[model samples]
Every structure is written in C-alpha cells, then in structure tokens.
Target: MAKGLKKTVVLVGMMGAGKTAVGKAIAQILNVPFLDSDAEIELAADRTIAEIFERDGEPFFRTKESQVIERLLNDERCILSTGGGAYMRADNREMILEKGVAVWLKVDLNILWQRVRHRNTRPLLQTANPYETLRDLAQTREPMYAKAEIVVEAEPGLSVEQMAQKVVDALVAHGGIVKDT
Candidate 1:
C-alpha cells in the first residue's frame, strides 16, 4: 500500500529499463499516483522530448528535467518515473535521495538494447550505431546509477507487472524505506 512508503519511490535507470511502465504498475499496486518527469516536461512545454531535444538541446531539456524532478519529488508521495539521464546529475541525485527512495532498475545491456533499439522516440539513441551509443551511455552512467539506495535487477522475460512487484518487494525488504505493515 501507498502508506507503506515514507517517501516517493523514484525509479531511475536506462531508457529501456521500463521505469514508466513499471512505475505505473507500482503506483496501481500501491494505490498512489504515478508521475513521470519527462511527461511532466512535455506537458509543460507542449512538446515531445525529442522535439525539445531537437529545438532547445539536451542542456536545456536537462535544466527543465531537474526542475520537473524536483517538483514531482516535492509533490505527494508517488511512484515517480524519471528520464534515463535524470540521475546523471549530482544535484538531481542529491534531490532524489533527499526527497525519495531512489531505486535503480538495473537491466542487462543486451536486454536494454533489445528493448530500446527499435524506438525512435529516444533522442540519445539517434546517433550512428545506436547499439554502441547505448553501450557507451550505459558504461558512462552505471556507476552513478549504482549509487541508488535500492538496486532491483531486471530479468529479460519479466513482465512489467512482475518487475513492479519485484521493486515493491525490494522496497519492503529494504526496511527503512518501506514498512511491511
């Protein structure tokens, strides 16, 4: 239940890690709202993330991202899904850790590639040889992601609902963040 958590469950991970989907499932199971920072940004800007990246650049998007993340984390406790790059910033990471329990949804590189390769919506993967780009991004960002208070490993065949349950189970197991009662 939502009452089990003292703070929001901030889901952080790579693009294909199913943060949004799993966050939705978690929120449903917990009886709380699911807030997505990227979606909030899109709603505020009246444009898609790819469009924002194309027009204003990533630095600008990231500035808005930090703003949205802070706002979302500041709101009522919920399952908050953040963009893949949100945890890459120290300030955002600090804010997340301060306001919510950060859960890193760690997925395998091959599984990540499989999940994201066909999606044109991801701006970061729009480079030449996206597989290599995703690998590079993962290698660059994983150490920071590893700093999350909770790390939930993702399996290749698990459904979104199952992953959400795994995340909630991990939270309960973590003790201080989520109470079993």
Candidate 2:
C-alpha cells in the first residue's frame, strides 16, 4: 500500500477535528506510517504539550513545533497529524506545501466545542472561557486552513473510520497527494 505514496498527507485543523484519529485510520487503510507532531514533540521533550508550553512559553514551543514539523515532512511519506496551531505559521505552511499535502479537516465550531469541552489535554483551552477562546481561534485559523491542498468536511454523524474514508476519497478524487494503490 505504501508503494503508491508520493508525499506525506498532513492533517491540519482546529482541535477536536479528529485529526489524529482520522489520520491513524487513513494510515492503516493505506498501510503507511502514522505520526502525530504533538506526540512527537512530547516524546522528544519528555513532557506533555501543556508542560512544554508552561515551562518554555508558547514561542519556545512553537519553535520546537516548527522544527519537528519540518523534520517529519522530510522524513517519510505517511499520514501526519499536526497540532491545531501548526498551520498558522507561514514557515510551517511553506514547508508543508513543499513537502507534503495539507488536508484540512473542516469541522464547525459547535461540533469542535462538543468534542473538546471535556478534554483537559488541550493547553490552549485552559482559559476563563474556553468556548469563547475556541471560537476565536477557529475564526482566526479557518482562512489559513482553507489554503490547504485538500479540504475534507467532518460531519458529526460520521464515525472516525467514515471520516477517514471521506478524506481518502477526497485525496483520490483530487489526485494531488495520495496515489492510486
């Protein structure tokens, strides 16, 4: 299945868009490696993303995020799930475009909120009003995410496997990243 891959498929979107889950499913379907940039960063730093942000600040964390993304894009042709903010940086966007195909998992704000509200793993949502924060972040990031090579709508009714299939179908129809296997 890996024989037809030409570039990495980088999943980008707001938190709770199921990037990691869908990415895993797609990688499994395609028989390719699956990587999550946030998980990679946490492993490299020997700490969680929240701890990295709290200890070194966002700027520092973003620096590391950029480096990790750059490395991942260059490392292999696989499915990569990036952090919510990863595509916001111009440098990261450039690298992703150059070396990989960015697939935005387009999910609405309300659905995103429902999926993420109970999760304490998101450091950015630890705020006085997390819903408002998420809304603002979504508004700010949507335009940039729209610049991705492929956009896959994430319906609330779709299971993770279903969403992954939707993305795979899009990639196949678009004929940009994932090659026919």
RMSD (CA, angstroms), candidate 2: 1.2
lDDT of 1 at 92: 97
Cα RMSD for candidates in order = 1.4, 1.2
Clashing pairs in 1: none
Worst window of 10 by summed lDDT in candidate 2: 1-10
Index of the highest-lDDT prediction: 2
| Tens-place lDDT digits, model 1, residues 1-181 | 3345689889999999999999999888877788999999999999999999999999999999999999888888888999999999999999998999899999999999988988999999999899999999999999999999999999878999999999989988887766434
lDDT of 2 by residue, 1-181 (tens): 4535688999999999999999999998888899999999999999999999999999999999999999998897999999999999999999999898899999999999999999998999999999999999999999999999899998779999999999989988888666766
Among all candidates shown, the one with the greatest TM-score: 2
- Model 1, stretches more than 4 Å misplaced? 1-4, 179-181
TM-score list, all predictions: 0.96, 0.97
Collision count of model 2: 0
Report the number of clashing residue pairs per model. 0, 0
